[model samples]
Target chain A: MKSILTEQQLEITIKRLAHQVLENHVDLTNTVLIGLQPRGVFLSDQLVDEIKKETSTEKIQYGKLDITFYRDDIRKELHIANRTDIPFSIEGKNVVLIDDVLYTGRTIRAALDALLDFGRPEKVELCVLIDRRFSRQLPIHPDYTGKSIDAIVSQKVKVFWKNRDGKDEVCLVND
Target chain B: MSLSTRHLLGIKDLTVDDISLILETAEQFKEVLQRPVKKVPSLRDVTIVNLFYENSTRTRFSFELAEKRLSADTINFAVSGSSAAKGETLLDTVRNILSMKVDMVVMRHSASGAPHFLAQHIPAAIINAGDGVNEHPTQGLLDAFSMRKKLGKLEGLKVAIIGDIMHSRVAMSNIYLLNKMGAKVTVCGPPTLIPKYIRESFGVEVNYNLKETLEWCDVANVLRIQLERQNQVLFSSLREYNIAYGVKRKLLDNLNKEIVVMHPGPINRGVELDSDVADSKQSIILQQVENGVAVRMAVLYLLSGRNPGNN
Candidate 1:
């Protein structure tokens, strides 16, 4: 039932994950991070900013992806998310796929399919802001996880960013 | 960070947020045009292929300016000069462009679903400039963007699109997009010119009487009366059609002054609309042309995700 991660804790976790990412991925030059649209995009930017501040390296290329079309949820309708604005070519770049939370993993699968259409990335590592230990449909896990919360399928965790919301926090909502 | 794509093909494919992003981006681009430099580094290395099978000047030029201002490399490919007239298939020409390592392709073809067709196969982002009288998605976006700028809010706004309903792809795309964004849409044209089951398909009202439709909305989008489709559709004569549907001085007098007048050009000055009305203060025909570039820029930036020259 406790899916919420405090603001201070989330910050510390992201910092730690950023450090770990820098440590494992030595060459920051070829590394680029792509955030899944909405929340992941903002999180990817944050991670890039934090990492840049820590390492004092050139800014990592950030890409946003809208995986709505790749989603298996809604039936094929005329109106669906079709335009994915990824300006930079992903070819040969070491990509760090960032998302707000790792839930059923269907989104990650969709993201992967969407990414491939752009071009073949040299390597792609999953980075989740929060990894909720639940029923995952696919074999996907975060290479870099900000925090982990164990919760039932019915429970939900919402990520609040500082830009939109004055504070950054994850709350447990009863769905 | 940098955008990854360069073109937008259709509105059906664009999300509500994406639509908003393009609108917002267009607003930003519009500000730059007012300045002296009137250029940006967003598309320096990006090559935008304007592969138009159909003949268009305003739309084509709008896209060209949008790309050049963004610092993108713009290639104007027409059927006359391009290999397509030399018996090349649509897919082959697109493949050739792809092979050339071009970043994006903005296509205006006579085939209704050409953009959709290219969107499926091409690696470069496909932008629907206008496709086979099926969907002029960019025009719809520009029109909606213009309306939103003028009206401030789109929700619950009554908008009636009149003239050449069946042949006007502008009307078709606008109906879908405008209705989706919370505007009530009514399509009006001569009964013969209006396609069968248009109302039932899109959950919108259909009216043949232009006077009634004009009275029902805050904005009346007048489509061009095609000279070619006149006799074929058997709409009697231009003079008769003008008397009924034209936004003439008399009709304009009857409507509210605040009720905006619009047309997707090149207009048939006195056929679907009077010259005075077309050139009036309320007409957004020129603004629509200007907004076309910004909308196209936004589309190009969003689709390819590549920054042209600068961020």
Candidate 2:
């Protein structure tokens, strides 16, 4: 296992990502942040917290999306679904999708399909903590990224959160 | 996580974990129904057939809608117009359908253990819609879902299944499920309508007085009088039964506290449940019907994901 980002680095990277998101959608009037379910929620939750702390605004239109039903590979395996709480409307707003890691791009593909079901958004942007380079199976790229790493197909990228994993770090593990 | 069993033949065959998994999954599907596009592609690659050897309204439509919502191709077969009317056997009918590459079978029949019989012979997963007076597993599941949604939890909750218990597959399923989930259940109705060994066999309280049962429970699930299923005279008449055991508004008004009312529909209003009580705010009868689709969706989705070798 190789540590890509330590505790201190992960914290700083999250703060930077929050600031980047704020800089793009100032005051976040019509902008919404959606976190993908199961694993990506940790990163999105942290990012939403940081954004709230910086802006002192608690009215951020944040939501959680579960794309288990929209996956193209559902026939191969069955995935248990998680709660999807989008209390606000995302009809014509700019949406930022947050996740922990970006690889293969299939989850993002499914996420996009799931998002369109809510309503058509003005624009949709992707944000991730780590971008695994040279391993995407689909044509998807992150608009805001914390760290970019190059890893082989066999290596697994795992992001650990303090809330869920008892630590904040990113590691690339080899089987 | 997948269910422990390959087929949903009865609530008697499910563990607490399996029931929890199904109810939890149904909660998610209920949210999907509120969205603009109330459909998912989870079972797009699969095909299912609904074989109803008995007459049905809500169960048939609920299963069909659940299948369509999951994007599964479905074929509806009623015994009235089907080849089964031409003196075809049950196994022969299923075998012919299986040859068409169907993945799952949703079946209802007047014969007890019909789905169980089909499951033994076919490679496809079987979901017993309702098998004679045996078990309607999906109805049992949706009832649990509605109760949990309303009452918050099932543990230690007092539920009374009132009406014709002897002929209700819903009653059997509910009793098994409620018992497994740590809920207290009582079968309340005319003494003749309820079985003799119910208390000893299922460990549920048996009540002959309707008003006493209503006052002692948190939820009252009144069942319709299955007149067609009764072979002998269980009661004097419909009027006599209503006066003795019908859930009337006057009786509900006399209760010290409010209790939820539920009915598996095609309600013989004024017989088992009065129209006013059935249409009251406490009645989750319609919500039970609405939740039917989601609960069925959860069942189909979970069973379809079973390992091929597992079945």
Candidate 3:
């Protein structure tokens, strides 16, 4: 059978991560999970679904962050960024930021700067599905990680979801 | 042999072979127009849509006449009084119109890649009438087509695009197409209006003085002064701009007399070019407008996948 993560393994991993979050974080009232654009939104939703299934309630809220304009490289040119529509309010919430793959942590830095425009959060904790911690430029670390892989910068690791391609698997492509 | 695919989004998308094929086909269409009846049976049953977001009466009329002369039905959709003002996105409007089963779409928009974006999604063949400052492939083709006729061959011809380099889509398109056609191109304008890295990127010379550029060129293609461009802080004043960059009678006399002058209309009569020069023996401005219809007709028929007369 050709599989990256078996259906049984993915279900077990979600439950484990939910229990880990519950053990560390006590306040669930004002807690929110915000996802980075594209794949991060999908991972955040999966985490939220697992938390709801375990607790039997929708106590947490979700939002999306688009950091296209906030990046340092876009300073020289015109700053007309792509769509950044956050439907839910994030004022004074305990936020858990989620992403699919974390490489240089520059995207997170850009997202953090963009988030300050909306409102300051009580706290911001980073969560990533696959953390290839080889190229770390900033003093940033993921609090909760699904898996960590040792790899060089010349390769790219892709996390496949069933919603995207009917499966959950990670593959490294030559960059 | 027929040209392979449809959709003319950029000159970058055209292969060298495809460029030659279009020029050759346009030559045939030009011949057909010179007859007693200035009409062809090339695209009889096809319907062409002139969907222009920008206000260009000259370009719009040219495309309309091009389709009509080719025996194709044409619908002119000007942006001012259209459903676009009712808060509909361009793609949504195009898709709704495409459902009517139009054969080809000739689009002119202020946004650079808007026509290319439409080409990717829409089922109908696309002809980029004009995009922002990015490209105007048909204008490039017609300019090159007209230049080739005068010079006999594009190889070793020195062509300079004078005035408004920054805001001129005509200049950008000509630089790429003329270079591809093997003519050495030079862009001359003020440093503020000219992009910083144009010379390094296109391998073309950039000069601030028109006299220096014209001395080395066989053809000088002058661009119009867009007053709205001044509002965008591209330049400061019109009077200063015309005195510095405008090509007048005195300037024309300074150039090589064999140097042909051309402008894409509607020209600013006294701003970028002198009215006498535009109306002179050296000017191919009127010839360019006349050739525009035939060139566009060839493009429509070629992209439509219909035989020139078999349709």
Best by DockQ: 2
If scored against the real structure, what TM-score would every candidate get?
0.63, 0.98, 0.62
Instruction: Summing lDDT over every window of 10 consecutive residues in candidate 2 chain B, give the lowest-scoring window.
Output: B302-311
**Mind giving the per-residue lDDT tens digits that candidate 2 earns over B165-195?**
9999999999999999999999998888889
Q: Candidate 2: which stretches are off by over 4 Å?
A: A56-59, B309-311
Candidate 3 - CAPRI tier? Answer: incorrect
Root-mean-square deviation (CA) per prediction: 12.3, 1.4, 24.6
> Each prediction's Cα lDDT score?
0.78, 0.93, 0.77
Residue B107 error, candidate 1, Å: 0.5
- Report, for candidate 2, the interface RMSD: 2.4
- Candidate 1, position A64, lDDT: 78
Residue pairs clashing in model 2 are: none
Task: Return the candidate ranking by lDDT, descending.
Answer: 2, 1, 3
Query: What's the C-alpha lDDT at position B265 in model 3?
Result: 78
Q: Please write out the lDDT profile of model 1 over residues B20-76, one tens digit for every residue.
A: 767776775665465434665545556778888888999899889988877788777
